[model samples]
Target chain A: MNCRVLLAQIEPTLGNLSANLEMHLAAIADARARGVQMVLFPELSLSGYFLRDQVAEAALPAGHAILSQLCERSRDVSIGAGFVERGEDGRLYNSYGFFEDGRLLEVHRKVHLVTYGMFDDARDFAPGDRFRCVQSRHGRFGVLICEDMWHVSAAYLHFISNVDALLVPSASPGRGVTQTEEPGLHSVRTWNRMQEALALLFQSWIVYVNRVGSEDGMIFSGGSRVVDPFGRVAAELALLDPGVVETTLSADATRRARVMTPLRRDEKPWLVQRELTRILGQLEE
Target chain B: MNRLDIQCELVEQLLVRFLRSEAGKFGFLRAVVGVSGGVDSAVTAALCARAYGPDNVLGVRLPYKTSSPASEADALAVVQQLGIRTRRIEISAMADGYLAPNEVADRIRRGNVMARARMIVLYDLSAEWRALVIGTSNKTEILLGYSTQFGDAACALNPLGDLYKHQIFQLARHLGLPASVIEKTPTADLFEGQTDEGELGFTYAQADALFERMIDQRCGEEQLVAEGFEREFVRRIAARVALNQYKRLPPVIAKLSERTVNHDFRYLRSWGH
Candidate 1:
């Protein structure tokens, strides 16, 4: 399957849901006119990142009217957007809603919440307990939030689950100086390297979208990119600028890359499981 | 351009845009800066001139009676180079009125009085000129709490608060500042013959390197020492940074209600505007 995808790099206003939803709608309409079949937005794009104690107020149910409208309008273009999801248990989650054919297809909550410098996601969100690839009209793909793909296990699981593409939404801050003599973006360079490595390792397309603009002193470097199965950057947006990057992805390329590399092939899941059990048995003894 | 040059250009552009946007948000298109014939003030004056045209920036030189004549000449050079308006006010009487009456002999107390006197003049000029007072303190000085509270630290908006001292020199050179100004020893000019490094007991280059490792790189003291920094110097710098935490923050308010100023009731500087 060959499909055109768009990474929407947007600057979201903190704690402004209607304004952000309008931005998303405008981006979707613009992407649709450009013949994009799939549109991916950054993590927490609906409510903006760094909400602190305001996360609860920004949380929306999966069946919110704005999300429903997005799903209803996604008949021709499938849309994947991040929002603060108010779980049924009254907890909040950083979730991505995948919509297609006038229906909400999959809701993937971010499993790994960052709790380091300038981040307090773990304090405000309940981590999702599971990870699974969802089948879409285009192909089977997996969705991961920022920091989730940093773990090798997450990438390995996604590859073993046979995902054609991995969509990652991030709100990474810009830091450090660039090495090159040119005016290159450092955070963007680091992110591109990581995404390319993951794409090459998994032999699957990787779409990474990040938010832009400064929010209360933190500058989000919006260098959204699309990496092909062969680890080549198909398309990239500029840093610290709100824009969209459209690129065509070929599922056949993933198939060919997997065959050429064969890193995913000749796998022994049962043997690894047996060895894990024997190690556990020995530890028990 | 090299990486440092590129970074300098990027930062200059960003700071210019930021200053303009921030000033516009506050319904002001004019900026007032206190130029002390130092690189930090020179860079701030240049940025302000670029942000709000040279015609809109006013450089005020508040000097004391004992201030060096070279300081005044250097400040005048910046005014002529940038083609911005300037005013010179002698504040020796204003500072001495408080100091001389008490027969103050303490150097720090006299310095603090002079610093506050300069700020008083700047704020008055800001009101008269209808311009926001731009800050000149760099990140190294801010981190070290080398600034006098409510004096050199007071500003409507600070463009150089994030740039380290060494970076300020680079930016000044990039902005085509006069060599005399950039090469001069950085001093608060609080007293004659008082240099910043002499007071701090360390050069800005050394402090900047240690700051890069400890603050930016998040290296511990042991790691910094192992990385070739003197342990005593590292410990002293760390202690200074820790002890000066109060200087970097706003006055701690007792939370007596559900909301208090700078607490739950906090808002952006341009919240209403």
Candidate 2:
């Protein structure tokens, strides 16, 4: 099915949740005007990235009063965004929350904890250990956090399941684009290519939203995209701009792509039935 | 050209010239950055190697008890591929026997120990080897007071200081860095698994673009708002960079005398009689 997806590549400020919420509202309104059915936003769109020790305190429960406020503001369209989630175990996570038809639907916590340079989530936020699908009124949707997309196992499981669309909220940082006159020797465009490749490899329609702003010293170039099943970018929001990119995904277009690719057939059998076993292993040790 | 594109081109061009000029001065003679197996250090290492030759460069991997095995492996990998000399120093005893950990705040004290320890190793190696200490700090980190004053921030010369985090990735690829090194999330490796972005609360691309438009281009917060940016983000970033300007400068002191070191009578050539 072709559904119009709005990718809101916003530049949210660190630690200012209120203003970030307002920007979401405005972007939602703008998406509604563009007749978009669903909107995707960058990870931690409300609180921003690089929260340091503050993430533990700044995070709210998935269904907290603040999330309810965001749900109300995004009443007109299905909005998916990343936020800090305080789970039942009292552990905080990098989570993506979904709101549609004026209610909360699902929240997906990031599974992979990126502990390399310049990232400190392993210190503050606990890594998630689960993956599942949310049955939205629009369609069966799969939600994953930024680093979760990097793990091919997660993508395999999500695609093999009933999810028709995958939504990813990211704060992927990279260098700015290179100029022709400049030697261009200092350019690294692999991060952009990585996202695109992941979308295609999954063979699921992707709505990747990224934040644009400088936090601490990391720069998140906002090159949000809406990719088709074939991995082609249907629409894109330019990097480093506080703007929205919208594209209509009709049910017909989705059907056409699915029929042409039939990726689900190849992907279904590969779904491992080892999830329970893994959880059991974790519990045992 | 679109004004934005033009500005991007201009900034990119300036970065190239700066890299070239820096390399011309330090490449063959001496160029080095401490490779902590982090993205920033890795990028700096690659740039230094590219500016000069790999044979002329050096990689120092200083590990403590808490340092990950992956860091040593990765650091060695970069050195081997780049064909640079490698030095592995275990500073656990030095830290444990020399410093009093109980009296210091956990994070700051750990940072101090790590920075000073790493600096001592790098400079000592630099002195014995006749190489310069290449700095790995990027502009966004420097602006936010996110780095140690004389620790990781101190360098004989730095080619990556003016560039932001996002730009380092670009340069990394252009310099043909190993995919593993280029793709890894940036981290200081101070802890078991510390990443630069997660602690900072924002990504490098956004920060670099924002810095470029606001600080480098001198665009006002109002302009960013009109451009559809979140006002709070603009204000907060601008404010943080402004507040942290001290981290980017030499130490400041009140001037009561006529011939203060930096402010007045600052003639380095005339100092020698």
Candidate 3:
């Protein structure tokens, strides 16, 4: 199926849940008015990133009124928004909720908690253990919350599952000033290359939405863009600015890319899995 | 290691945004800067002019008795170029008031006193004007602890902390600053004939090169030596960085309770703002 989608690149007020909720509601209204079928928000759209102790306060339970409010609004446009989820086991998780048809659909928890260099995600939230595909009215999709995209296996698992697109919610900090090259942040360039590679190899669309604004000294760089299955940027927003952008997903383009390359069709997962077991000494054990 | 060079046009946009956003978070739309006629302060003032129009930025020039006259004239040039409001307050009386009674004899003691007196004046005006103080200390000064604690280092926000000294000159030229500021040697203007390099016994370029290798590349002694840095010079620079570390952070609070201010009860200054 082919449909239009909107990326809401917003600057979240630190630790303010109700204010961020209002932001979500306003963006949803705007996207719905534009006839966009899906809306994606950046990681921790409800709770600002760099939440030292604020993670606990920002955690929402499954039956939370806020999530319910979003669910009701998603009847027309499917929504993907990031929040700290309070688990049934009482553990907190960095999770993205995909809602449609006036109900909460699949929720993808961030499996990799970044633990190096200005990141202590593991200290705040528990890790997610599995990668699951989300069935949407617009298209089949996968969710990767920021660091999940850094790991190849996370995107590959969804590729194996045959998703049409991967929605990545990122709150990455802006860093590294470009000197000899064009005027831009180095981190953003690195992110662009990774998205292109993942899109081309997996033969899937990459919808990357990053947030803007600063939390203390850390500035979240906003260069949200959608890459087509052929590894080309279809649309993008400006860097370090809060803005919304739109792009279209088409079945025809995906079909053309895959039909020409046939990389996925030629893939052998069972053989690879067996080899992985051998490499990991599982067969010997 | 990353290149020390910066895209000046890009940095100008980012610093402008940083000044506005960080200041706005605290309900401030006006900025106050202590313009010292140096490239660092001049570039900072230029960014401030762009962030909160010239009408909202107040450039205060605090001059001591021993300060170079050219310093004052060059500072005026910067203020005139940006069209920002300017104020000149002679700080000789304020500094001598304490120095006379305390008999502060050492040059280091007198310099520290003068630096801190300016800080007191800036913070007081920040309250009167209802504006935040924007700092001008760059990465080189901050990394080497070459600033006074709670003195020249005190500010509500610092957009230039991440930039190196070379980048400051790069930005100054990009801002179209007066040649007097961009080409002159940098000094704190605390005493007569005291330049930063002369006092530190080394050049800023040397320090920048050493740090780019030693800190950014995570190079050890052997690696640094292999990279052409003198082993003795590396040790001396590293010692300076380690010794001056206190000036770079907030006062360390002892943990007496389960949740302390900078310990378990950690949160950013702009947490709720």
Candidate 4:
């Protein structure tokens, strides 16, 4: 189950589908040359983030020609990337696609659309309805968009669903200063802390990829990284610079972490389900 | 260096890189900045010099008839230290061409005319020199709406828009700006003996400290008062910030369709690239 993954920290051209697709193809080729099994891109990698009405024009169907070309190009390496998807219901969704072996494996619509300061995703996109872990040739992994991993429940659902690794694609803007007086301390540190907690608690590997470069005055910090089950940073890219970070993950580490921690062994899904049902019933009454 | 100094250095590097990338993105290898001998413009000129190289940066000094001679000397001092190319343009005739016949006596009205006149000279020179016009407005002035619209506020890009006035002084000192420019009383210098603090009725240091507490720290009025800020001062500053909110944003348009310009029809600057 050991595999090498490359995190592509790219500066996407907003609403330029062809240009973004070309960047993705180049990164995929680079990953393949490095013998990487999988490459992960940041959120909305195809159309860039912070697109208001341009999201409609940038929306692609699951079988769109560009996606087909990406899937075709993914024959040598698996590609995990995000894009705006136009559903059959005519609603647009912030979506992630997993492509492998010249085929589209899975598409996960982002569940939580951020609507806070500087974000208007809720106004632009329809929220995803469900969450599920997808199986890959390397291992079983779960996908989470930027704000999804912020909530403890999202990671808990993935952990209970038995995912070996959690992949998070984000477009978080860099803010605040680091303890060492570096920029992007606030947003980058928060992301790292959340990923580490989830990895250590779930005894699973975590891969977090964020975009870089400024778009319309908003700077996206590109501190893409991978955390092992021991909450250790395996590999990381530079902050605010577009680059690639490739790291090899050991499957045995997860097994050893689970054995040592034993946090997941004493789980009780039935009790949790019963409690949730009771709480919902009480709230309804 | 202390924490602020360390942060200032990091920001300086970031801004230098940002200016270079932004200028190159817009197909310009050079920059044009209007240096007023004030801290804001001096720091901006220094940054442009660092970003585009002193040879590529054009520091323009546009002085009206009543502008202080000392202001021009300080601006020249900056140009000399940075070793950048400079142009001295007298704006008095241009501003008076329209203002004289109308007999405009209002100080505010005349000040705006001079500001707009300076912008006109900078923009025309920008076209001739093939350089982007970098802005000199600081966060304190922008927040207080102390700038005249479409005048000194106009720019192709602004590196100093995010830094407050006091922070601008810190950066100016760090960039080796002339002590005279950094230590002088802040002024738009629109008229003889005119100062920014005299016009605004509040010192920039006071406004900056209050802004850091109220806006950045999210402190309430009561909290601010508890922290030793005068109640009346906090109230007045809060009112000014609220009233001038429109100046900080793009012009508003009524939404009539599914997608409107700037409101819904948004795209990044890299779209054309």
Off by over 4 Å in 1: A178-185, A271-285, B1-6, B13-32, B48-59, B83-105, B118-134, B218-228, B255-273
Q: Kindly list the per-residue Cα lDDT of model 2 for residues B130-190, writing each as its tens digit.
A: 7778788877788777888788888866666766676666666666667778787777777
Ranking by lDDT: 3, 4, 1, 2
Q: Write the per-residue lDDT of candidate 4 for residues B175-241, one digit (tens) a residue.
A: 9899999888988899889999999998988998888788767999999999999999999999999
The C-alpha local distance difference test score for the whole of candidate 4 amounts to 0.87
Native contact fraction per model? 0.08, 0.00, 0.61, 0.31
TM-score of each model, in listed order:
0.88, 0.52, 0.98, 0.94
Docking class of 4: acceptable
Once fitted onto the true fold, the runs of candidate 4 whose alpha carbons sit more than 4 angstroms away are A177-184, B1-6, B252-260, B267-271
Ranking by DockQ: 3, 4, 1, 2
Pairs that clash in candidate 3: none
lDDT, candidate 4, A1-285, per-residue tens: 798999999988778889899999999999999999999999999998978768898999868999999899889899999999999999999999999888989888999899987788999999999888878898888899999898778888888998999999999887653125444457777888898988988888999999976676677878899999999999999887899989887889998998888888888878999999999999999
Top model number, DockQ = 3
Tell the DockQ for candidate 2.
0.02
Per-residue CA lDDT of model 1 for B65-155, tens digit only, reads 8888888899999988999999999899998898998999898988888889999999998899888999999889999999999998999
Interface RMSD of 3: 1.3
> How far off is residue B42 in model 1, in Å?
2.3
Candidate 1 yields a Cα-based lDDT of 0.86
> Which run of 10 residues does model 4 chain B get worst, by summed lDDT?
B1-10
Supply the global lDDT for candidate 2: 0.72
